[model samples]
Target: MLQIAVIGAGVFGKNHIRIYRELPGVHLAAVVDPAVTLEDTPVFASVDELLASGIPIDCASVCVPTVAHAQVASQLLRAGIDCLIEKPFAASLAEADQVLALAGQYGRIVQIGHLERFNPAVTATMPILTKPMFFESHRLSVFTPRSLDVDVVLDLMIHDLDIVLTMVNAPVTEVRAVGLPVLSPKVDIANVRLEFATGCVANFTASRVSTERVRKLRYFQPRQYVSLDFARQDLLVIDVADPAAAIAAFTQGAGLQHPSAGLSLRKLPVENGEPLKLEIESFLTSVQTRQEPRVTGQQGRAALELALEINQMIAQHAERAGLL
Candidate 1:
């Protein structure tokens, strides 16, 4: 069995610990957290303590805060341990690159915690996502003081950015973004518009000051429109150019109109499942096979770079508005 170590015992880190403890073909070697006492397992005060103990660890899940990601991940990589670092890989793109370079040099695997990629709703919609002409997404959460250190672009919108990059499959040509610091010292709300080389465009908005949580994505294609509700785990597929009578019959049967009566939407059902488990399973598979993960360190760096750009734009806008 592959021996794994979990660093950090915060909210997210606890979830990682649980998953690692239960995952098949893996042994939870130790838990390292300076902030918490790991009562269920052998606990180390810090990663240094565990590494210095000479425990056999093949991989580690770095669930530390975003600011500490680089230092922790780099140390592990240098020690020849593969890693799965949580989202927004590091505080900056340069730091992310350093971890990635160390992974490459040491021939170790590194995966990013873009958990939405493993969501069942997202997986179910992948096969039908053909040449998206336009995409829109919104990820909003009720006020939580957890991520006040960074803007909403990195805290929330980066998830959509990772998914968009996967579906669009084209180089981004331009990005326009705006944000404001409504509830926190950092930007709490933001919107970004991405123009792709393949004529596909994605407009994303995220807010941490909202009253209700929402996670949704809408895709417009040539013949159909697909909408996914990550919160509800529901998918909707609508046929735009239904020219046949059978199409009309199907729509009529489903209480849908002929695109003229505003009843063109169709619902697609998705199986409910835990996305985090899927993500961890994928990471384990990559570790066993010596293959690159679906969400690699480089991909995480790209998303972080774009997120930083959005953060900059928001800062500039906030400054011009005299709200800084």
Candidate 2:
């Protein structure tokens, strides 16, 4: 059985601990968190303590705070342990590079916890992608004290940014963004617009101060439109059967019963599963097979780079508005 440890006992880290215990062929070897203790597993106060214990750990989930990510992950990698790190890879690009370098040097697998990538809706939408040109994404959540070390861009919007970056596969040409602090000292709500080298445009809004929770993305391609609801694990696709017929229908003011008009709508089937569980399973698979993970360190760094850029834009906007 593969032995895994969870560093940090915070909200996300506890989930990782639970999932690791539930999954077969894996043992929840230990947990490293000074503030928390568990009955079932041994708890170490720090990474140093865990390493000193020599518990035969095969892998670990680095779910510590953003600032501590690099430090904790570096130690684990140096000790020859593969890691699955939580999102916002590191506090800065340099730290992210540090973790990446360590993982490369140790010949270990590293997967970033961009959990939405494992969502069934995203998985279902990938095969139908045919040059998406426009994207509209919204991710909102009620105020929470968790992950307050970073702004909404990194805490919430980075998930969508990662997904979009993966889909677009183009260089970002321009970035325009604005954000404000609502409940926390950092930006709690923000709007970002990105232009890509392939002429695609994307608009993203992320908020941690909303009254309701929402996680949705919609995109349009040449002859089709796709909608994804991350929370519901739902995917909807609408395809124009014939562009000429669609145009003619609009021009001729044809009724719904018009024989020449053609539009097909489908609700794609999604095999919904707990995203975290799937993410961990994928991470474990990569660790076992010595293969690259679904979300590699490089991809995580790319998302972090863009999120940092957007944060810079937000700072500039705030300064211009005299809010800083």
Candidate 3:
């Protein structure tokens, strides 16, 4: 059985621990957290403590604070442990570089925890990607002081940033952003627009001070318009460019109106599964096969670079508006 250790036991950390425990053929070795304890599983104050205890850990999930990601990941990697570091990769690009270098030196597999990439909606959207031209994304949540160490861009917007980057394989040519701090010292609400060399444009709005939670992304391409609901694991695709296949399906359904007015409407079939569980399973597959992870260190760094750029633009806008 593959032995896995969780490096944090906080909010998201607890979810990781629970998922690891539920999966078969994998042992939840221990949870490394000084502040919290898990029943039946040992808790180590740190990765060093766990290593010193000789628990035979094969891999670990670094779910610690953003600032501590590089440190914890470095230590584990140096000791020949593959790691799945939680989102944003690291607090800064330099730190992300260090984590990448350590993984390279140790020849260990590394997976960045961009959980939404594994979402069923995104999975279903992948096969239909032809030439995306425009995107509109919004991710909003009620105020919480959990990740105040970073701004809303890093806390919430990075998820969409990663998704957009994966979908649009073009170089970014322009960016415009605006953000405001409502509940904390850092930016809690942000709006960003990105233009790519391929003439694709994307608009993103993220907020941690919203009245309700929302996670949705909609995009339009040459002949298709797709909507994804991350919370509901739903994907809706509308195609008006091709009416032949649409009309046939509509006729076969006995005028059921599967397609309306030469428009093909489809709710794509998505294999529903918990994103975190799928992420962990993907990491384990890489570890066992000695292959590259779906979300490589390089892709994580690219996403982080874009997020930092958005933050810079937000700062500039904040300065112009006298919000700083």
**How many steric clashes between backbone atoms does each model show?**
0, 0, 0
In candidate 3, what are the lDDT values of residues 1-324, reduced to their tens digit?
999999988889999998999999999988999998667999999888999998898999999989999999999999999999999899999999999999999999999999999998999999999999999999999998698888999889999999999999888999999988888989999999999999999999999999999999999988789999999999999888556766676667735344444676789998899999999999999999999999999999999999999999988888898877
lDDT of 1 at 235: 90
Ordering by lDDT: 2, 3, 1
TM-score of each: 0.92, 0.97, 0.94
* Leading candidate by lDDT: 2
Instruction: Write the residue-wise lDDT of candidate 2 on 1-324 in tens digits.
Output: 999999998999989988998899999999999999789899999999999998999999999999999999999999999999999999999999999999999998899999999998999999999899999999999998999999999999999999999999999999999999998999999999999999999999999999999999999999899999999999999888887887788789985436666777789999999999999999999999999999999999999999999999999999999998
Query: How many clashes (backbone atoms < 3 Å, residues ≥3 apart in a chain or on different chains) does model 3 have?
Result: 0
Residue pairs with backbone atoms closer than 3 Å in model 3 (clashes): none
| Candidate 2: segments with Cα more than 4 A from true spot | 247-260
TM-score of 3: 0.94
For model 1, residues 292-317, the per-residue Cα lDDT tens digits are 89999989998898888777777777
User: Which window of ten consecutive residues has the lowest lDDT sum in model 1?
Assistant: 254-263
